[model samples]
Target: MAVSFLSTVPNLLPIVPVNASITSAPRYPTLGATVRCSKIEADADNEERFKRRSILTCFGATVGLELVRSSGTFVEMAEAADLIQRRQRSEFQSSIKDTLYKAIKENPDVIPSLLTLALNDIMTYDKASKTGGPNGSIRLSSEISRPENKGLVGALNLVEEAKKEIDSNSKGGPISYSDLIQYAAQSAIKQTFLASAIRKCGGNVEKGNLLYTAYGSNGQWGLFERNFGRADTQEPDPEGRVPQWDKASVQEMKDKFSAVGFGPRQLAVMSAFLGPDQTATETLLATDPEVLPWVQKYQRSRETVSETDYEVDLITTLTKLSGLGQQINYEAYTYPVKKVDFSKLKL
Candidate 1:
């Protein structure tokens, strides 16, 4: 989807389909562009994009895997939500969706511009190093200009599109743009996990069957849910909120996340995902030579180590960074889903 905007306007980005999953949710009766909300059929092509939010986002109408995986659109989303309401799925799995609804019903105004940083896994970060700059600075215009954030404009503009549609259709009550954007992201994560669960067990996808996420080395987390209610901020986030990968060393990244209640292992997990996915393997080495080291060890380990063992280790550490046991909900900050190897899918 594309939005035409005057060229002279600064900081106003044109809404384009940067990430496919975040397509237009369309206003009530009319069909918007075939944005993420478009009612699409599920198939193999969709599966490749549907599986992971750490890199890209894809949208589809149904939820299933023929030979692989695919995404879920409003239709499948409604079905899964209905199933969850009937207790077939855990309430925890629907936290993201629930939060969006709650945000719209309560403080609808904060919906737009609130979900900017919700997608920490977006691979738009540039390799530019900035150790010399302040860590948590929120210079809006300058922030967007940073090399690390080069490709993020597309998602940024999407915030406006989601806001426009949801607010217009808000007769049931308006929804802020941020709510829809956050919903789209969280929706992708929930659907991908649930889709994989259905692929494995061949039953209704819900907390009952999707509780495969292990918490501690010996214990397991019943489900993954993200909290909501992030209010929109007038300025960009402070510089230090996200890791300064281009400038900071691995230890710095660990320290930064650790300062906010995360640990080194979780930092490692986040680092593994920051690899430039848009850069192909042929060019990945040269595109960002530094990234390979962080993920290389894990990928190489995948070759010799048991895939389950490696994955379990990653998930266990990820529990900390991804809010494994934290008491977060729609009224609080949500956990970020670190990338997991989707290749292990049974399908």
Candidate 2:
């Protein structure tokens, strides 16, 4: 028998009330011990080693038990297990992406909120301290209640609804809140691009999907999709980690962006996430000497029907944003399946 890690887990975490507030919270905890934010950086070599170790570990524990009693050879069983994991992960990816697309399409109002939720979740990183980034701490009531995260509870609730559907269909276990939030944002952005194409085509859904699919760069979204297995933070992040978006000055916004290694071009391209109106945001940001040129450049790209330049930049930025301070579990979505076909055996 293959080792089954499948177990009944709760579909969603218990949500804290949106109105809950925790004043006087520290921005980052200092419990007389250093927290290593960069300790688990994901790299190519590290990922390869992790995958190899996981496969070998699982294979060792199960092969002996099955090899003695079963007809399947060790190589065949191991290959079957690896194949099952890959197939399951790919199917889950498609399933969850479909769920997100349906959720966003049926209720287009959630797009801005979803983008903001994802943005707030990621912006908590302080590169100087190397702490906090897209860990889903924003799901905590205390984190979302902050001034910067105002009007975001709706987005969180929407994600919770999607989570229920996703977890119900998941064979492994519940999807992590951290992964869901970032992925929902990615889906929302793609939907936004689709919406633009649909509008240009006068609400022709078929043509819009085809046109965008043909014109859109799958490589960009693929970059974001390849990253998974983000764990959630139990405690709310330290206060003041996110910027007060509605009230922050242009320079203040610039400083925050710089802290995360973003430049004027990124800031200009991501203006839609900063506010409801991308054009208005560009107009406001145009006042900044450093940001004006990029804003103007993207505005010109917007003149084209496809807005390909803007779409490419947004996808690239979002892909990077979703991974800030992340330590991915390359095997998170891989679940077990029947290793041997006993029914085929001639008894």
Compare the candidates by lDDT and give the number of the best one: 2
The whole-model C-alpha lDDT of candidate 2 against the native structure comes to 0.77
Determine which window of 10 residues in candidate 2 has minimal summed lDDT.
7-16
Scored by TM-score, the top model is: 2
lDDT of 2 by residue, 1-347 (tens): 11122212112111112222223222353433322211222345345433434434434444443345354466687887788776787788899999999988888997888988999999998788877999999999888889898888988998999999999999878899999999898888888888878887899999988878887765667768778888888988889877876677788889899999998888988898886666677778999999999898888886677788988898899889889998988678887665698889999
Q: What is the Cα root-mean-square deviation between model 2 and the actual structure?
A: 22.2
Regions of candidate 2 where Cα sits further than 4 Å from its true position? 1-83, 341-347
Candidate 1: residue 152 Cα off by (Å)? 0.9
> Against the hidden reference, what TM-scores do the models get?
0.36, 0.75
Q: Give per-residue CA lDDT, model 1, range 83-169, as digits (tens).
A: 543341233324435544444334333322232233342222222331111111222456655655555455445444545554553
Regions of model 1 farther than 4 Å from truth: 1-142, 171-182, 188-226, 246-248, 272-275, 278-347
Count of backbone clashes for each model?
20, 1
